[model samples]
Target chain A: MKKITLLTLSFTLSLSLILLTTGCAPDAKSHTGGAESLDSGLPSENIDATSILGAESGIAQAARPDGINPETDVDYSILSTETVYFNYDSFSIRSSERAKLEKIAKWLTDNSGKRLMVSGHTDTRGTLEYNRGLGERRALAIREYLVGLGIAQDRIFTISYGEERPADTGDNENAHSLNRRAMPGVITK
Target chain B: MRSQYDLNSMTKKLYTVLFAASLGALLSSSLFAIEVEVSGTKKIAVQISAFQGADAALAQKIVTEDLRRTLMIDPVVSQGSYSVAASVSGGSLNGKLTDTARGSEVFSRTYSGELRKMAHEFSDDILESLTQVKGFSTSRVAFISGTQGAKELYTMDIDGANIKRLTSDKSISANPSWSADGSSIAYMSYRSGYPDVYVIKLAQGIRTRVAGFPGINSGPVFSPDGQQLALTLSKDGNPEIYTISTSGGSPTRLTRTRGTETSPSWSPDGKQIIFNSDERGSNQLFTIASAGGEPIRITTPGTYSAEPCWSPDGSKIAYSTRTGGGFCVWVYDIATRVAKQVSPGLAEDPSWTCNSRHLVYSNNGSLYLLDTVTKQSARLDNGLTNCTEPAISR
Candidate 1:
């Protein structure tokens, strides 16, 4: 009876070790094809907290008409200088545009009640659906920067206009460069 | 002697006429029956006779134009293999199609409705009888129109008639996708000053916000069963593929990658979804189970491919691939695993018609239908400027 008890203990220990390793390891199936790593390397607790906050804020926004309308409802000119531009076919924050986002992040912290709506735009170079996705990634990149600087994830909303709304409608390179941008507009509660 | 020779020559002439007449009758009854051919290059020669009665000429004109647009029939004045006889009177149209070579009536029907609609019906019937394939005459296309931020959603007939504005939102709208039943359209609109997916039931004019995710609710495509929608949502961390109930509920994420995923199209069986992803570096096509699984890449890396749409027959996928400085339409055969470029110049947003052989895509601010078999394309004149992103009902 004592030998049987010892065998059960060993089996239990091995099973627990396997479970622990798998639970701690990053998802192997998700990282196939040598694709970019899924981890953002951010604190796990921080991500969980932000997700919970995001859910609560989503519910609150759903209870009311929270988004801006008519393009005249909000005075976006206040943060006009903070409109960050991106390179062609890219969403990475350039070193030149870092200062603008930092200023906007500080302004958001100072005005705690105000939320930021990052409207992402793209040039008319790619397919419309793909551009919409690209524009979205650009806006999310800006939001991530702000969130990294201590702004709450729930306070920033991102929208992609794609190539539909352009800052300059000309077909020249000058217009395209101006069109690929992420504009941070302040929305009051 | 000369009179005797003339009598013999006359007898021979009489015999020749009788023999020729008998042969003609035999050919008409047995040899000249029309059979449908699979080749797209050969079009049936159809002679449309002017109709008789009130508004008969108008009916003739409408039918003629509709038949010409099919690219399967060649309208001729005479010596046609087939002939159409139609008459419009008292809000009804009496139409008849005859096999000219066989000298037999193929079909005869009476249609009553709007003159244009009745004519379209007759034309469709003629095509179906000749080709054994359903006609696209009654099909409608929903597209986005207007310049800059003032774009709105509009629907019109395949021939560019009966233009109807579906949305008056002075805000921008993009990526209009049709439900399989053609009763509703789901599109991404910025009317709320944010990109949100909205579905408009064409009959009751009821609009519902199906997806209002916090960040980037775009590229909404209805499943084949119409019970769910596959879309790209970035509400969770990064842009990912998700499926949500058509009536609006919690979205089920289908893809997990650091790359951006968009343009999700469901297979005909509704089991698999083909979408565009940049997970492998460049935008390429990938297929994943609708329920959620690891995505298998469909296109070669290093080339940009996007806006994928599965053909109705489940045999092929039509998408736009980036060519030297411009985009071209390509159809990828699922079985053979071969991709063929079907368009010559700049083309994007390819949506397949119900026939699956033709595609309606936007190029240079206009929509064009391309015959994949023949590689021939015809511009669709919607009479609207700056039109793009065309979605045709199956």
Candidate 2:
């Protein structure tokens, strides 16, 4: 318990020191004085400190306009096991993947107030734009299946990563099949 | 006998002089003549003399490289149809283009800006004066750089310099499409944990969410007029093409296809849109009137074709076709209706330069500039790995 407290205290001191150094350095702020800083129009407290530090380090990063970090706002890993896979160049949910969606639907029913965010993905074999559309279809297919399972349509949101975020970054068939998927995440309404 | 021989020799010498005079006149008349065909078969030779003053070598180098990449101008040391005389002094570049054949000045201008930008401007001016076609030297390409798995929107000069990250969303961003005037870029980002279309004004650094519909909101491409964006939205059930005003408003649906439709590219005149669809079981290119109408299949079915980009000149549509288990960039002649493969292996997302004779495509995570007519290509070295979805400003 004592060690945990000490570590927490050191981490807090380091974070504050970082903020002080970044706040004092005009050059660091000036480097990000372009579009990103002007776009958010949000206060510094609401902005993600790591993203600001990323900008200070010359990696230009944009803060969310609403000042919400989705990574921390919603935990996607809660429904990780319920993720469904798709066929090659296809968004049709295979018969084998039906149980996964049923599990997710049951979880959504149990949670009641929580919504679902289904992120669709594809293998890196086709054009990015086309894959994006395909990924959307995959997510929509899952949404339709979940809706059929009695989940409300408005309670689900969908996004497509196309081939951008691949589960497996390999060039073989196994990786391609593994990459094509629709992952369900639990999000607060 | 000697008198007769002398008369014949004088006649021969007179004829030779006459022939030389006519040839010289022809050469002078053809100097800087505009070639109607953009096949890049003939290149005008321009002599770029050694620049004078500070930063002379750097200025000359950049200008020469810009001209060379066009595949329209051949830079030589001497004996060129045209010549460029340049000098840099006190943060200013003065350049003069001369028609060597007629010994007349074409244009002279003074440019002040970043050294590389000034050089590009000078090169563009030279190209315009010679061919009457605008050069793409000053144009920028907005692309998605996926370095470290944090896909972000970034823009760079056509020559791959001055890279600026327009978004640090710390999330996936893709399909960057620039406004016709190059003032703004419309792209999709998952910043809010959902796909949303946003337009970022480059000068002001302001971003406005244009489309955040219930389902997937993606593939936002600016219309030629920069007023409307034709994008893919699944709000109406399936992925379909819809046009929305740049400002937030109700979107006008263009396609009612049950299959997926995305990547809508507008015609230069803003009268037509060519996009990709899989309504026939396989993805194919289709064209439709910008106004509500039926979509006409442009590519043959059975083969996979997607990511259709209409050239700025409205003469060709460049797209990626599945060939030999990999994607290759192919250009479909609008007039001839013949599709010819312009790239070799794994080339996709072909974006045309302003000249419409060159295309910038992504292959294996690197962007490449391709001269469609000459089949010459060069990899754009932006020093960033995993860069894709290049949208060159027309």
Question: Largest TM-score belongs to which candidate?
Answer: 1
- For model 1, the superposed segments whose C-alpha errors exceed 4 Å read A1-70, A106-114, A152-155, B1-38, B300-302
Cα lDDT tens digits for candidate 1, B307-364:
8999999998899888766788988888766677888678989999888888899888
Among these predictions, the greatest DockQ belongs to 1
For model 2, the stretches where C-alpha displacement exceeds 4 angstroms are A1-70, A73-79, A105-115, A151-156, B1-46, B74-82, B98-114, B128-133, B300-302
Q: Model 1 chain B — which ten-residue stretch has the worst lDDT?
A: B31-40
DockQ of every model listed? Answer: 0.12, 0.07
Among these predictions, the greatest lDDT belongs to 1
Candidate 2 chain B — worst ten consecutive residues by lDDT sum?
B32-41
Chain A TM-score, prediction 2: 0.62
Give the CA lDDT, 0 to 100, for residue B123 in model 1.
91
Residue-level error in angstroms, candidate 2, position B1:
37
**DockQ (C-alpha) of model 1?**
0.12
Candidate 1, residue A82: how far the Cα is off, in Å: 3.3
